[model samples]
Target: MVERVDEQDRVLAVVGRDEAVRRGWLHRIAVTVCRDREGRILVQRRSEHLARFPGHYEVASGGAVAVGESYEEAASRELAEELGVQAPVRFVVKFLNRNGLSPHWLAVHEAVLPGDPNPDPDKMMWHGWLSESELLRSMEENLFTPDSRDTLSHYFAAAERPSGQP
Candidate 1:
């Protein structure tokens, strides 16, 4: 079962992923950004069989949270399921997705990959390690999913900000 969440991302109910999305419910999503030893980000090409944003590139590995699962729990599960690697996850931020296609709450997390990722064939077509500039170029060229595009921009912009500022 999937989690149906409130505006604050508090659990409101439980339902199937398809049904939750069909009803435009506010759900919790866990987005994980994995960096390589050289600090390049791992990006994935989504499989065509996926429900949303099929065949698009994603800079993060993630999915909706299940019922009774916390953001951290989902992040760990998704990281392993999609990339087959595990590392300590640092919580980043959360926001509401108001796009007509995916109305939900998104939680961002960061981790370091131990090595190259072994992507699930059913979840992704391939994976690549890209520098921040390359990732931004790809996004500007519209090669990434809407969610990934927004999340990457937000994450990178925040990472570049001065520490003392809010």
Candidate 2:
């Protein structure tokens, strides 16, 4: 079940994921921007079998926020599920993504994996770690997931902000 929400992200009710998709109901999603200790970002080609954004490259591992789950909890679960790693993640930003397949409030987080990720084949067909510059360059040549691209942009913007500013 997914928690349906209003434009302001206040939960309205719990509904089936499919129903939410069918009706274009707003919901919560948690995204994680993962990086290795060497500062290379992890990128993956999503499995072609997935219904949404199949075969697109993504810089993050994430999914819908399950009913009763916090954004941090969802982010942690998704990172482990898609990348096979358990690590602490920090909250980054939250914003409404109206341009995606469906509208949702996205909570973005950041994690530094302890070691190489063993990506699940069911989620991604290929995975690699790339420098920030390389990832930016590759984005121009790859069909990357739109939400991940937005997450990356917001993440970079947050990093560039002054510490005292929101």
Candidate 3:
């Protein structure tokens, strides 16, 4: 049984429909943050060995929020683990509904790195910087996770404006 915690971080007994569900504890949340330099946003190609979205492009960093960890903590950990770098993360948005998978609450963040993103081969196969136009075009031609597309759209909209606009 997975322990559920309240906003105050106190452990609470699982209850109601949440208790009846057989799926593993739904406590994990993942956040994906995409950042750009000079109109190009960093993107990572998931290793072909990935269980889902193999060989597909996705935001620079993302992973499961560990038990008792906050959304920002998970996002920062993922960024460091996947890219070997660290930067201040700014919350952009959150996505909570996905079908056919364990439910996850995602807190999207944005951050600008000092240089190119170097993907860790152990986690991702490749990385690159693509303009919003190019990313959107790719989405039109093939399949990406709905989460990716939604997050990309938000990033694109933000990038369209001048610095400090948001």
Candidate 4:
């Protein structure tokens, strides 16, 4: 089940994924940018059978926060489900995607999962590790989901900033 929320992120109701996406309802998603010990980023080619952005590239491994799950919990769950590994995830930031397409509240996180990720082929067609620069270059190529692109930008900017600053 999916949790549908309002502008303030308060749970308004519970619904199925199809209806939520079909109606563009506000929902919560936990996104994780898993970097290896060598600082390479994990990227994936989404399965062509998915409802949205099928066969496209994704900058991170993540998914919707279930009807009753925290952002961090969803992050860990998604990483394991999609990548088959567990790592301590740190919350980065939360932002709303209020666009016409696939609107959802994105909870961004980053982690250093220091091992090979075993991606589930049914969910992802391929997976690889790319340098941070290569991941940034991916934005220019328009190869990622809109939310992925936005979250990556936010994550990068946040990473470069010094502490005590917004």
Candidate 5:
């Protein structure tokens, strides 16, 4: 078993070894899904040096929430660390893991920005605008993080519905 840690670095719960085998204890991660005025989502290519998910496209910016930090704080920190820009961010979704790949609760956010994105080469190597349709296709093709695909699907579905409708 593994102990899940909260934002304050406190142990929240003990999870089974099998559960940990897939994703381990639950952790919080911040994900930023920025959209341009054209309604295209920003995707990034992970650095080749990344230990995991190397050379794959992913959310605009993301990272694990630090101990003693809020989701917003983690989001902003990741953006600045990975994208080198500042913008307003709003909470859009919270994705809970059901597959046991990782005991992570994703805090997804949306950030609107002007002009093109300049990715930090240290963490990311490429950036591009992908429409929702294209993103779904990529997800089907296994081009993104497993957790990201789930969150994006939920976000896309919510966006397609009328306001205040679930």
Candidate 6:
């Protein structure tokens, strides 16, 4: 089950993930951007068997936030589940992504991987690391998941703002 949320992001109910998707209800998704010591971001191609954005490149590893789970918890879980890494993730930003394939309140987080990733074959087919500039250049090919693309832009904007400025 997923936690359904209202516009202000308060919990409305805990409903089936399918039901929330079918009804176009707002929910929570937590994605984590894993960076190496040199500041290279991990990039992954979703497995083709996946239902949404199959075979598309994504900047983060994440999924629907489970009922009763906090975004930080979900982000950490996803980072471990998808990339086989256990790392502490810090929340970076949260906002409503009403235009994505699965509209939801997205919580973006960042983590520094302790070691190289061992991606799950069922979730990711290919994974690599790229600098921010390289990722931006690759996005020009238009092969990335739409939501990840949007998240990248938001992440960049957030990083540009002064500390404590929100």
Model 5 misplaced regions, further than 4 Å: 1-23, 98-101, 160-166
User: Which lDDT tens digits does candidate 3 get at residues 60-118?
Assistant: 47766665667788888888888887877877755553432445455677878878766
Best by lDDT: 2
Q: Which lDDT values do the candidates have, in the order given?
A: 0.83, 0.91, 0.64, 0.86, 0.72, 0.90
Ordering by lDDT: 2, 6, 4, 1, 5, 3
Model 6, residue 8: what's the lDDT? 95
By lDDT, the better pick of 2 and 3 is 2
Best by TM-score: 6
lDDT of 2 by residue, 31-136 (tens): 8999899989989999999999999999888999999999999999999898899999999889889756788998989999999888889889999999999999
Error (Å) of candidate 3 at residue 75 is: 0.6
Residue 61 in candidate 3 has what lDDT? 78
* Candidate 6 local lDDT, 1-166, one digit each (tens): 9999999999999999888888899999999988999999999998999988889999988989999999999999998898999999999899899766667999999999987999999989999899999998988875898898778878878878999988
Candidate 2 backbone overlaps, count: 0
Measured against the true structure, the TM-scores of the candidates, in listed sequence, are 0.90, 0.96, 0.74, 0.91, 0.79, 0.96
Instruction: Tell how far residue 104 is off in model 3, in angstroms.
Output: 1.5
Candidate 4 least-lDDT 10 residues: 93-102
Ranking by TM-score: 6, 2, 4, 1, 5, 3
- Candidate 3 has what TM-score? 0.74
Spell out the clash pairs found in candidate 1.
Answer: none
lDDT of 5 by residue, 8-37 (tens): 545686655455446566766677889999
Better by lDDT, candidate 6 or 3: 6
Q: Model 5, clash count?
A: 3
Per-residue lDDT of model 4, residues 8-52, tens digit only: 999999999778888999999898998999989888898999877
Runs in model 3 deviating more than 4 A are 1-25, 154-166
Name the candidate, 2 or 5, with the larger TM-score value: 2
